[model samples]
Target: MSLPHTPLERVTSIKRKLIILIGVAVGATIAVFYVGVKLGAWPGIAGALGGVVALAAVWFLARGLTRPVREMAHAANLITRGDFDVRVSAESRRDEIGALARAFNRMAVELGETDRLRRDLVANVSHELRTPITALQVHLENLVDGVESADPETLQTMLDQTIRLGRLVEQLLDLSRLEAGVVPLDIRSFDVETMLQGAVRESRLVRPGGAIAVRVDPTGLQGVGDAERLHQVIANLVENALRYSPTQSAVEVRATKTHEAVVLEVLDEGPGIAPGDAERVFERFYRSDAARSSEMGGAGLGLAIARWVVDLHGGSIRAEARDPQGCRIVVELPTAIGAA
Candidate 1:
């Protein structure tokens, strides 16, 4: 219904400004020729009309050529203003600007994702802190009001909550130091099965009567890293598996040595990660579909720390959907030099 404007004209870009400027100049020249034609200069008027048509073509070409750059600048401004959702399409272009535009879009997506994760972190942390603090507060209040007898069991429950809060804070601090590169790794060659068994022991100690198992292949495999830290990684994963799994279900840890690396897996019979959520499980404060109540869910720092530990050892870690039902988290670490 309306033919006055083109898509290029709708956007405020450098190219659009050039089109307007050139159009104004060409329009003025055409106006002068039209006056000459009114004075009986028909030949000049015809030449002026041809020039006007040429200028319009130039404007259209300019718009087409500079549109991606305009989109790039616009997207940059939006990102600087804390908006990361804007994107520029550069898929078909083969120019340098096209590559830059594609890079810009990638940055925007990563930033948007980071922002969303930050929001979730705040929310989850608030909930985690509130749960333990509220419990402690209630226990103290009961004592103050003399509403309940100050039994040893009540005292012990309050103390346990206090310890849990302290542990969460400590884990947060540890993660921060790790990310800041303040925590150094003590790499050493040792049997990784020791770490695996330690983690299983920890899981059973914390959850008595829980089904936990470990299987190591080909006698054993030597792993190189901070055995203590690797121990922490295995424990974190095993604990998480135990947390999500049904009480009587078995949680298994398996380690197999390949030619160049050793692969470790933690398998649980919990509701598996939904499609596409496998990688995100390593993100801080990110809980899968498994019910992460205050009593069961940790501070959400364990997997994040585990990821860092694996990365430091030149390893890769990921979660996969298990067969039938549940999730399997796998970690692969390079074998230590000269390690058996």
Candidate 2:
């Protein structure tokens, strides 16, 4: 993460240390000179020279001690100026100061990550909010200008847009609660097939013209999870498929028991997700250019929410391109006892 730029306080700590070192060095030299003069061991001039050498040695030692301090101060200033990349190269002398420097570097790295995530969150939220709001505004303005009458069809379309906006708001609120750890799961054991059937049935009701199909292994795959949330997960995936697949193309939902888990897949004949975008598609407010412009109703939070629900249940979900055409989303969850 990039460090923020801010001015750092000047380092005045070295001044006090320099004063102490100079005073000690001067006092030791004076004492040696006085002793030499009293003992008459050598000429006074020779004793003065020896004292000078001793003071010089003290000065050199003081410089050695303060050099690292000077470097550290410079680094701190760079960091304060939002340069998190700056690092102190002091050796691991097993000293407290060295440890503190290492810890400071780590904290900078974490702060950068936090800042990046915060920016992404805000951008994604804005994009998601704008799409539906813009659509509703345009439609409302047309009606106000008498471009569209209050006919049943026009009124119904406007009502649908309003409902879509409301749903988007609700989904955003739900996602916020889930991310904040405020939503608790009602975990229990249930037949995965039963849940899948219900979700497929509901989706069919909404897109009756779509040729969506469901297939199950019928081996009675069971899982421990919040059934309601799991149902939502299935519905979201299927609905996504419905939105992307061409009219008359089939959206398939399938489930089978793996060795250690139950795998559920929603496959569609729509243009497959680009390999580069497979993972990012699960991110909040991420949509392909085609999907973004399509009339499918969504705020781009469905996949993110589904992933969260699966994660809460100790499961995993991933998307991959299907052979020849389309994309497949696979969800794996631990199988209930006696089902494996």
Candidate 3:
């Protein structure tokens, strides 16, 4: 992408300035001809010829300058009416108009992407919401009709569906809050290892027999950030690891303190994310073909929320294929000052 033209370039662009200049010149020529006719007949004929020539020049210049803008204006109207595919043929020009064309193309691309994501979000959310709600309705109906109810198994299933619905709603709301930037980060310094241990414990609760190994470079891997939010980030990563990994496969948590930052990695022995999906895995409502189990996965919001929290603390999070097997999620955060 070429840099946008500077103010100096805009002023100096002869082609861009000529469109206005042509209109003014045509008007001046006509005014001179009108005055010359009032003065004398010969002067009027000569002035009229000059005015006619100027008018022709203006017509050509107007077509060249205004055609692209007319096309763009029509396309913009279509876009406003919910058409995202309309494109203008102005990118080939090497002037201010070309810059406008490129910007319009970029806007169209972004609007198209946003519209697609919006549709996907609505579909996914509806599907996710309906599943548990349908299950609950069925269970309630059965109980009301006296066809079922005293059994512990049936009750438990309904309870599980309710829990699932609640979890999904909570995650969606949290995601909204984070994205809106209303959730403030209470920054502070604390022991990151302690938070890691807590997250590992939570993951173990999710999968009782799964192993979560922690490997820290230094004794106490201290970090500085909102500890509670960081814990949520860690737990989400660990839960994702457990959900995809085998029953007894080990998930590793590695931590190290660098010169100016604290780095943590969560490694899972599951089918790793595909290269194409690595960048998009953190997108809300996104599911990949590389996913271990499409039906069994969470509402596809965990990684997105985790990323938001990490970013809140001036941190970066990324995922990659683990060596030889599995997937790795790395989180890097800036360390607070003067902490040993």
Candidate 4:
């Protein structure tokens, strides 16, 4: 008996394959025995010939069942050696081996993505840390060598760089804690309008001339969750808006209540995010404009932190393009009853 090397056999169900294998082996044995006996060969010789014929039939008929398993073993070895690009031919088989191959492909994709993110994180962190450190070092060197005097202006510039470095480090730590779930939420019901107002006031204090505004529809709306964390989310959004907005343009913070959730929005009169980057902007260390953000002392973690906080509170956040030119970020949090 001969096995046909065709894809149809691979797509056939394993049960059918097994049935065919047993049928072929038994039929081949009987045929060989009958031919040997009709040719006047000894009974023992005929039986031995029948056994050899049966073994050959079984081996040929079973290759399809074992080929995929062999391929998977080889692929697994490659994966262990850090070769995520290796893949087995699933051949569209409707069997367990096919399913396993598909799942293995998915896992390889995920592992490759995770490795890429890890590498990006390391590189971005190093770059972020170096910028401020280099600036501070240059300033200190100038002062020590008498290249520049330790006047109030020079000292203030040095202090600003130091503060930026400290802020970046603190944000990194906060993000780490949030991702690890080590920071517990202080969940409770609080006034959404008041919180928005406080965030606006704080932004106002930080940039006295920035145009920031807050509005709550059906005023005195309340929300359920960690007040402080929610405040951080709002503050980060407002600050992000202000950073890109034109000096004379307003950054509007709005809150409205719906049947399902409490919706908060921040709108800015700045260049809007491109459609492709709307989602990626929330990724850690991902900046739409790296040079501009660095000049603004942004370590590209504000939106990332805000996303983490919103996620922890069982909320959703997204970026939108404001009409006539600008950007809007929307956050929706579970209401008290919904949260419960």
Query: Which candidate leads the pack in TM-score?
Result: 4
lDDT tens readout by residue for model 1, 1-340: 1123343444345555566667765775676567667777787666677577656666664555666677788878999999988888753454465567768878999999989877877787788889889999998999999986799999999998998899888888888788888888887888878889987887677666467778888666777778898888888888888877788888889999888888899998878778787887788877655545434677767889899888878788998888899889999988863342
> Whole-model Cα lDDT per candidate?
0.78, 0.76, 0.82, 0.83
Lowest lDDT sum, 10 consecutive residues, model 4, at 1-10
Ranking by TM-score: 4, 3, 2, 1
Residue 62 CA error for candidate 4 (Å)? 2.1
lDDT by residue (268-336, candidate 2, tens digit) is 998988998888888887887777777464767889999999888778999999989998999998765
Clashes of 2: 4
Instruction: List TM-scores for all candidates, in order.
Output: 0.67, 0.73, 0.81, 0.87
Looking at candidate 3, the ten consecutive residues that score lowest on lDDT are 1-10
- lDDT for 183 in candidate 1 is 84
Error of 1 at 34 (Å): 26
Pairs that collide, model 1? none
Can you list the residue pairs that collide in candidate 4? Answer: none
lDDT tens readout by residue for model 3, 45-157: 86877677677656544455556788899999999999999888878666777779989999999999999988988898999899899999998999999999659999899
Steric overlap count per candidate: 0, 4, 0, 0
Query: Clashing residue pairs, candidate 3?
Result: none
> Of 2 and 4, which scores higher on TM-score?
4
Off by over 4 Å in 3: 1-41, 270-277, 287-294, 322-324, 336-340
Residue 145 of model 2, lDDT score: 98
- Cα lDDT of model 3 overall? 0.82
For this target, which candidate reaches the highest lDDT against the unseen true structure? 4
